[model samples]
Target: MYADDTVLTVADKEIEIVGRNTHLLFEQTKQYCTANDLVLNENKTIQIIFSTRDHTTTQNITLPGLENKSETKYLGITIDSKLTWKPHIDTLCKKLSSSTYVVRRMMQKGGLDTAKIAYFAL
Candidate 1:
């Protein structure tokens, strides 16, 4: 397995690791990479020891491809768009028109307060 350059970022600190065959040196570094949201690009990766203000560190692991696909999770919103946008666009437009009609009615009734609120909310 090829070990790539590791970039450790914590808070506002950034440490770059450079060396060769680093995986044998740091065993648990892969888990650390995942926990820290560090992405390794396999295509253009290298291994090295990065000397920081504290000490020198090494990371050895074959970084996966950057283009690897993974599941996306959101707050109760599952969006899987497989080139289908017509239905979504239509629904959005319908809701918008309905809201516009409600505001128009409020404006006709001289309820400027409600109309203004609805208009701005949209």
Candidate 2:
């Protein structure tokens, strides 16, 4: 009925319990949505496991219809499964470089004041 971010996480010291509880929670969410007339959009849903485990270990738990991604962007931040900041920093650097080039071109053309260049940097 409505779209929103829904993240259900179940964690335990035991891997088996974690898998079982996560699956149970998924089932519960399905039941709840059915009772409430809400639909889970698979396209908007992504399953991300935040762990140090390798691909084989992480691949064990799967969300039925949704894709499993190493990284997902939310609110302009890139969040990776292993919690690395590389992607976000890379994005910021690229944007800053592009904006700097525009500002430099404008300055050379005498089209923008230094104050306006400072504003663009911001």
Candidate 3:
């Protein structure tokens, strides 16, 4: 009496699925179904297919307790996980600030000597 479907395309054929405590979730969902006198028919389930330009594959994936949590990956990068922008941004800012300080010091002393300028440019 419940169903959901999703479709996505990937440039590469590699795909991965991960679940946390999947066995426990499955047990809970099964118990709920039994208490409600609902019958789960595998034959009535819809299928999910993955295909690439060169190859094809299919799988039968079930939802957990009427809800599902999945992580998506494209070209090998996980899209569902939190992306940390602060650390990288802070590092880049520090590098740029350090370079600017050096440049300003050189300009204050006189124009940058050719060797220093070349080193900084490198």
Top candidate (TM-score): 2
TM-score order of candidates, best first? Answer: 2, 1, 3
lDDT over C-alpha atoms for residue 68 of model 3: 26
lDDT of 2 by residue, 9-94 (tens): 77776666777777789889888888998987768888887777664664447767778888988888998888999989988999
Runs off by more than 4 Å, candidate 3: 1-81, 112-122
Error of 2 at 40 (Å): 2.2
Per-residue C-alpha lDDT of model 1 across residues 61-121, encoded as one tens digit per residue: 2233332122222232222223234545666688889998989998988689979987998
The parts of candidate 2 lying over 4 Å away from their true place are: 114-122
How many collisions per candidate?
8, 0, 0
Best by lDDT: 2
lDDT of 3 by residue, 41-95 (tens): 5344322222323222212233333432233333434333234344456666877
Model 1 per-residue lDDT at 106: 85
For all candidates in order, the CA lDDT equals 0.47, 0.78, 0.44
- TM per candidate: 0.32, 0.77, 0.30
